[model samples]
Target: MRRLLVGLIVAVLTVTGLLALRAELMTVEVEQPEGSYTEVLVAADVVRENADVRAEMTHGLVSTCRLLVNADVVEQSFRAVGDGVFAFRLRPGLDEFDRRELRGCLSDLRVQHLRVHVRHLQTVTPADDDRRRDGTPAAGRR
Candidate 1:
């Protein structure tokens, strides 16, 4: 009976290992795009203060820049409305880094309207045909 139990345990362990391997193999790997997403460090300059704040951002790709805050995995992309003004679509995962960056802007102008300027840009290329075949914008491509 002891021998039978040991054999069963070994068999279960082996099956589990095989299942893990299979799972790992099933995962799809995505390569970083050539210019899909670019990381840009921005400094917000506040120009006015009120119920709604207004600020301007200075960056190369002001129209398609997202801010990753605190390394928390949450990113907010700003849409350029006009002149240095941008619209931020609020999303989850706001990290300490984002808060710190915003704070820096507020301190500079004492308001939420921050003028952002990108200091660093990380550009990636677009995804492959398979991703676009299904009409998917590729991971983080949009």
Candidate 2:
């Protein structure tokens, strides 16, 4: 009986050790690919409509855009650059599809008075150049 109990304990310890090792080895760090820093120009009418709570409206817009693109928003990226011009950065920049979707979603706001002009401020990165040379789409594109 003693021998059987010792064998069982040994087996349990072996299993536990294997599990710990497997867990350590299997841990993965998923680094989201960085994308473009885009600036969007909001229409004056839309800004006027939300003037009372402009900051909150901006946060909501950023949150909605983040969800729509399924990408991370750069911290403190939302700010007014000029009159009715707001800028924000998204990791894993928007593809054509994402851009269209974002436009459609934003159009639904403020009874369709919202107009946004999205412009990518940064030029293509070295990684993008490599990908283009390799004939593969950039990081977030289909």
Candidate 3:
């Protein structure tokens, strides 16, 4: 019995030491890519409609825009800015062609009472100071 107890204590101490060493030496590194996106504001009567129906319309709009622009929609970037106004954030800032195409697509949604009279386009880019020594934006900066 004494021998068994000694062996068990040795095993427990070995495991505890191994765990402590692992805790001291383990390192975690996460790398995030830097990129730009565009902020767009859409104004239409459908956006200000009943809250329940408005959610459905917003989802449809986001899906439609994703298909039409061939761009990734920034996650959790859709929100209502004001009465009859909603905003969307699209990855990789839209160019001139994209802007024109987006405007045309929104106009085509007239049947849903979506009349986009105000389109606010803004580009988000990392500042110079945020760049790494190699001149690219640091990881997770975007």
User: Among these predicted structures, which one has the highest TM-score?
Assistant: 3
The all-Cα superposition gives candidate 2 an RMSD in Å to the true structure of: 13.6
Q: How many steric overlaps are in each model, in order?
A: 16, 0, 0
| Candidate 2, 30-129: lDDT as tens digits | 4334544333444333544666455456557667766965767678777777666666666655555555556555555633434455543332344776
Ranking by lDDT: 3, 2, 1
Native-to-model Cα distance after best TM-score fit, residue 93 in candidate 2, in Å: 1.5
Q: Write the per-residue lDDT of candidate 1 for residues 1-142, one digit (tens) a residue.
A: 9999999999999999999877644423344433333333344454554413333333322332323221221244655455444444323322333433433442343323554554333332345345767787644322
Off by over 4 Å in 1: 1-36, 39-79, 82-125, 128-134
RMSD to true structure for each model, in Å:
14.0, 13.6, 17.3
Best by lDDT: 3
Clashing pairs in 3: none
lDDT of 3 by residue, 41-94 (tens): 777556445655664575576668667766677888888888767788887655
The superposed Cα distance between candidate 1 and the true structure at residue 3, in angstroms, equals: 50
What TM-score does candidate 1 get on C-alpha atoms? Answer: 0.23
